[model samples]
Target: MRHLVVPFALNALRRGRSIEQFLGAAGTPEAPGIRWAELRPTAEGFALVVHLAQDIGGEGSYDLVEFPSFEREDGEEDFGCQIAVVDEPLAALTIAEKRLGAGRDRWVNQGMAGDEYRDYVRAGRPPCLSASQSEAECPET
Candidate 1:
């Protein structure tokens, strides 16, 4: 997909979290106005769903993105610049930091964007991507 995603999701997942729970869990460094990022693995790579839980006076919607991972000529992982916005949710989207779980395997979506993040109370959703955080990574996909 081609959606813009905040970097907190990857950072928080590295810390053993699905969606970041505490404000400081993944809000450091840039401190996005909005919070929460969910990552799901795809057969070719992975998918990311970011929720902008808009306030009473704002608009809330789901932005989706995908990254196709591959191996380079040297046998090393080469996630090319092929970030595209996928229509599919990859998995159930969730805003709960704690319930979102961590990334699959050691891969985490690493990218940055915060101008879109807005304020919010909370959102409803699945228990996180803990069921299978196995294989995928997107560099700001």
Candidate 2:
């Protein structure tokens, strides 16, 4: 995992200060379990996109996971896992999750972006989240 995580500092933000390096992992990019995931820059923070099977009896599609990020005094962040895939465009959707992770999560048809997503994130590249996930936390030269 070190080979893949040496670049991003998400762990820093995900669990506060994370200096430990993952040295063991077993899989190739060609592996079947390798799901497609990408980070999207949003005005407030970032969103995740992954291509995978939708659900039971459902075909695969791009699932966007938008976890509400909240920082704690202990340095651990809450990654609200409420997952869902807006069948239509992001703009035309509204998502709501139950508190304490109970009940079913729902989304309504609505537009999230009036024009585009960048219009929300200050119009430039988002700053590095943390040192572990810092843009500069790269491997040795």
Candidate 3:
């Protein structure tokens, strides 16, 4: 799985080696998706940027997603901000993962042109809720 390669990529970035990873098939404007993620070492830590699958008339583009601050196992708090340099390679990759995860349900996840999407659309695009119907769902924002 692609997840297994993430740690090695992070290690390479931490060693000052910029890395680019192709995440999924290219997408369209109607449903933008993450094409690749770039990691560049920085003075503060590192910068993570992702190329959007759909470009503007063939021109390349990038987008960043905000990740909520999470408590670290050591009891430290993360900044929980987007487009900010991260202090650790794993942290930067974590942000990139969060960005990639945002589009986890897009058609690209299935394939370049998988028929499963048609069935999903016909099925009313049911969501993968965190809790079952028997359990309380997260309150609406």
Candidate 4:
């Protein structure tokens, strides 16, 4: 089994839902098992790197999974999983994409702009800032 880096961003795991739950929800029947290595918090949010054993068939076929922290109906901690189509060598790209997707939404909703906003995106090390940037500023990158 090859070691595939599965990037995920989650809360402190102190809540009722843990990373394991997120993985189960995101994983497909064919998906290989994952072993989490690190879960670090960044300026934007948390960063998770897990070693998984799976066969990534081809480009655009691999699934990049993410689980963002949320609150459960019972006021307990919860998370929701999201999946994305990714290319080969999924490690860095998966993390970058998750950060971009999550960060972009946060920025747009908060109306963040200027250098501070730029720095925020930069911190995530996104694969292609242009693709994740807002329509107005995307062409500038």
Candidate 5:
């Protein structure tokens, strides 16, 4: 089975380190059809975000679709899955892993980005999901 995050990130998170990483489409960098995930402490609690790239069009630009989407209440617009917020890091990590595994094929995680993903986590998980929003705040990156 394809792992959601690398072993290092998973182990680090289990040990209570806040980190983020993405795995998908090797050699494409931030091109369309890439997926990334992050686990960090937030004001509310530990937050886990797994986002998939959706081609929004315009010069290789794209948007993101958070995974593990839940059903909205009646009359609510189905934008995407809500950022999973939990009181514990392990809980968030579990959900993140599950979400990533569920779409393993689409994510195309060929295990080629392992080293780069580790560097990304060490770099404080810089925003690298959407090239179109490089200047904008990555709420979901």
Candidate 6:
């Protein structure tokens, strides 16, 4: 997936404004519809991924915005410097880790599980592909 890093100013979200209100005041069209999932602290300030209409011209535009964080001393504002946009799950995972320090344990566990499943399918005698097959019957990778 392509990763695009851009600058964004998101002082509004850091100011305790709801995601909807922030997006509304940020000039994002309401018709396209905006939905917030969660906020994770990134290297800059915070990372916010909002799902919007795919029909939008910049369907996957990554806009970076600076926002104020309470952690700063003297009420200093933290700047959001980088924004990354990507479509691949793996790429997204990597970006998340680099940008937000997100843990990769979950992703690693999922990959291991998928590998085991594939190995079982490929090594089974007579190749049992049915989901009803007993785990004992499947060969280990």
| 1-141 per-residue lDDT for model 3 (tens digits) | 322255566566667876544343333336433234456787778876544323222111122222222344467553322244788877766665565442222212112222332333344434431111211111223
Q: Any runs in candidate 3 off by more than 4 Å, and if so which?
A: 1-7, 25-34, 53-82, 102-141
- The true-versus-predicted C-alpha distance at residue 113 of model 6, in Å, is 24
Tens-digit lDDT track of model 2 for 1-141: 222232233333233221111111112234311111222333433333322211111112212123223333468553322233333222111221111111111111112211112221233312221122111111232
Q: How high a TM-score does candidate 6 get?
A: 0.21
Off by over 4 Å in 6: 1-82, 106-141
Clashing pairs in 3: none
**TM-scores of all candidate predictions against the true structure:** 0.21, 0.19, 0.41, 0.17, 0.39, 0.21
Residue 35, candidate 3: C-alpha displacement in angstroms? 2.3
Model 5 residue 28 CA deviation in Å: 13
Question: Taking the tens digit of each residue's C-alpha lDDT, what string does model 1 give over 11-101?
Answer: 4433444331111121122422223344443453334443322222222432311222233346754422222333333222332222334
By summed lDDT, which 10 consecutive residues of candidate 4 come out lowest? 104-113
Q: Evaluate all candidate structures by whole-model CA lDDT and list the values in order.
A: 0.30, 0.23, 0.41, 0.27, 0.44, 0.28
Best by TM-score: 3
Q: Lowest lDDT 10-mer window, candidate 1?
A: 20-29
lDDT string, candidate 4, 10-98, tens digits = 22222212222111111234542221122333343443333222322223232323222333346854332222222222332345344
The all-Cα superposition gives candidate 6 an RMSD in Å to the true structure of 20.5
Tens digit per residue, CA lDDT, model 6, 46-117: 443432121122212322121112222446442322235443344544554454333333222211222322
| Cα deviation of 14, candidate 4, in Å | 30
Residues forming the 10-long window of minimal summed lDDT in candidate 5? 102-111
- Distance (Å) between predicted and true CA of 90, model 2? 24
For model 4, the superposed segments whose C-alpha errors exceed 4 Å read 1-69, 72-77, 90-141
TM-score of 3: 0.41
Residue 141 error for model 2, in Å?
46
Question: Residue 35, candidate 1: how far off, in angstroms?
Answer: 3.2
| Local distance difference test, candidate 2 | 0.23
